[model samples]
Target: MTSTAPAAGAATSGATSTGTSTATSSSLSTTINPTFRAPTPRHSSFTLSTISLCGQPEDVLDLQRGSYALWRDRVEMKLAIYQVLDHVISDVANPADPEWLSLDFIIKGWIYDLITPELRTAVSSPGATARTIWVAIETLFRNNGLARAMMLSDEFRNTKQLENPLSVYIGKLKAISDEHRDLGYPLETHALLLQLVCGLHERHETIGKYIQTEAATLDLLRLRGGQALHG
Candidate 1:
């Protein structure tokens, strides 16, 4: 009762302290800031390094003999590149398109791996298109034409089926035969059949004996063999 109403100065001081606290809180809420970061940029032209291709081009068996080695290596590389570019082979509309650029990049990566340093320098040129590179490779390798074809033919002829099925052996023979035909030398259907028969592994000797008779058709040979196996 003695001090309750007499402390006006103390009441004023308490009011000032509360007001200062409120103002400090308001100042912090208004003045605090947030930071922002910028996004990363991307490259314009499609670019890739050489590690993508699994292996170097297979050397032509004749590489040790003479100039034919160059052709064989290039042909081997061409086949590999064809496989790599199989999807885009049909996409031939615009060279300036991004898809084309991507194809060019892939061709480069595989090519870089396929070629040795010497060949790379020989073929490298500024602003070279993919088609140009293809042409250059073909031109370089096609030098020893008939000799290369003969080598492929010899390999095809000697390709006897050791332990594989007729289908597998025939498939291998067919690939060699196709390349053989591309070089302007073709075997008759009967000749191919004979090769098929002669190359069979000893397990299929019964089927071989059946097909060895005169006037045997490839269709009939497969039919009789399948029936014999299943029956």
Candidate 2:
């Protein structure tokens, strides 16, 4: 489904409507761009209501030109916040008439905090949709290729599960694995299993070593280990 990417030209961005849903009319443009509409379902947020900004405004993602990894790291952190708040990057637009409330809140939080006035010219405008800004940021920073994926995979391989919380370690591992998947170089199931098993302490290894139920996926082994740890 079409999403609200950054505008190609100077005109108000055309919307990609879902059903009859439409974008909130922009204050900057008196003439409505009928082509513009809300984005596809944005999977985003925390407990929705309880998502207070605990971190500083500077912690938000930036549009300024920067290193790809650094920019992506910030974006990941921001997306992690959105995920916690129950926003899944699907589409932030409401299924009904697209309320700019969510988009406005995002832009307002981002406007003065992370972006320069020059950068803000694009996103803080009354015309910018959340998804538009979101995609724009990705376009600005999404560096992907064979070399990057290989580097990410190597990082994944080196990321041993030290003494850190199992859940946290697993989350990081899964996140890296997901990046690999998105980049079209996903780890094979067996390769992922080996990486996972490599992280477990000797104690947790026993759970998987003894499990005889058909063939357990690596995820299940991790789950079993978690249960054993908490037990």
Candidate 3:
């Protein structure tokens, strides 16, 4: 009986130590699990550089040979599709915004790539916005006058299918007509159809006669469909 109290005290001390260890372990587990937080599950970001435009435009801007109207239409449509048309058409963001500046730089470089080396220098200036470059290029190519209209009209009438494919020949005529119209001298649809037929090669005589015969009923759309079939 001499050591009974000591043994009981020892057992009580052991039980208390076990309980404290269990409590401490539980506290540490709660703290560590919460702190881990599954590593916050990082998410990637989207930016203009990540965007894909599918491909560059088919037509490059050449004042002497390229159709400005066609090139503009294609380029603008592409920008609109990618939701970046405002970069070239309007100021959609703050000038000081870093993100907008990056996008603008990218678009400016793209515009420069699409034009001839000479036109690039003529349109671009120090710290110029995309809209400024766009307007400058447009002014260079689309300045309308009686002299330009007459020159395009002559080119339109003189176009011949010859060895060129019908599609290409029609494209030339349409481009000339578009430029002439931009000069406030729109040709009549019937007259355009006649010129389209007149420029056809002898091999296309049958279709040309058909177009001439049905001139009143056939529209440009139908004429283009016929061209695709026979092109």
lDDT of 1 by residue, 11-101 (tens): 8878888899899987776666344334444322343333354433453223212333344455456545444443223435355777657
Residue 181 displacement (Å), model 1: 2.2
Q: Each model's C-alpha lDDT?
A: 0.58, 0.53, 0.75
Task: Identify the leading candidate in terms of lDDT.
Answer: 3
What TM-score would you give candidate 3 relative to the actual structure? 0.65
lDDT of 2 at 139: 51
Per-residue alpha-carbon lDDT of model 3 for 95-208, expressed as tens digits? 797667777777777788788888998888998988889999988765635666777777888999899987788777777777767657888889889998988999999888
Ranking by lDDT: 3, 1, 2
Tens-digit lDDT track for model 2 on 192-228? 6566677766666674354333135336345535763
Winner on lDDT between 1 and 3 is 3
The segments of candidate 2 whose C-alpha lies over 4 angstroms from its true place after superposition are 1-133, 145-147, 208-215, 218-231
Residue 84, candidate 1: C-alpha displacement in angstroms: 12
Candidate 1 lowest-lDDT run of ten: 60-69
Q: What TM-score does structure 2 among the candidates reach?
A: 0.42
Ranking by TM-score: 3, 1, 2
Off by over 4 Å in 1: 1-106, 114-122, 125-127, 214-216, 219-231
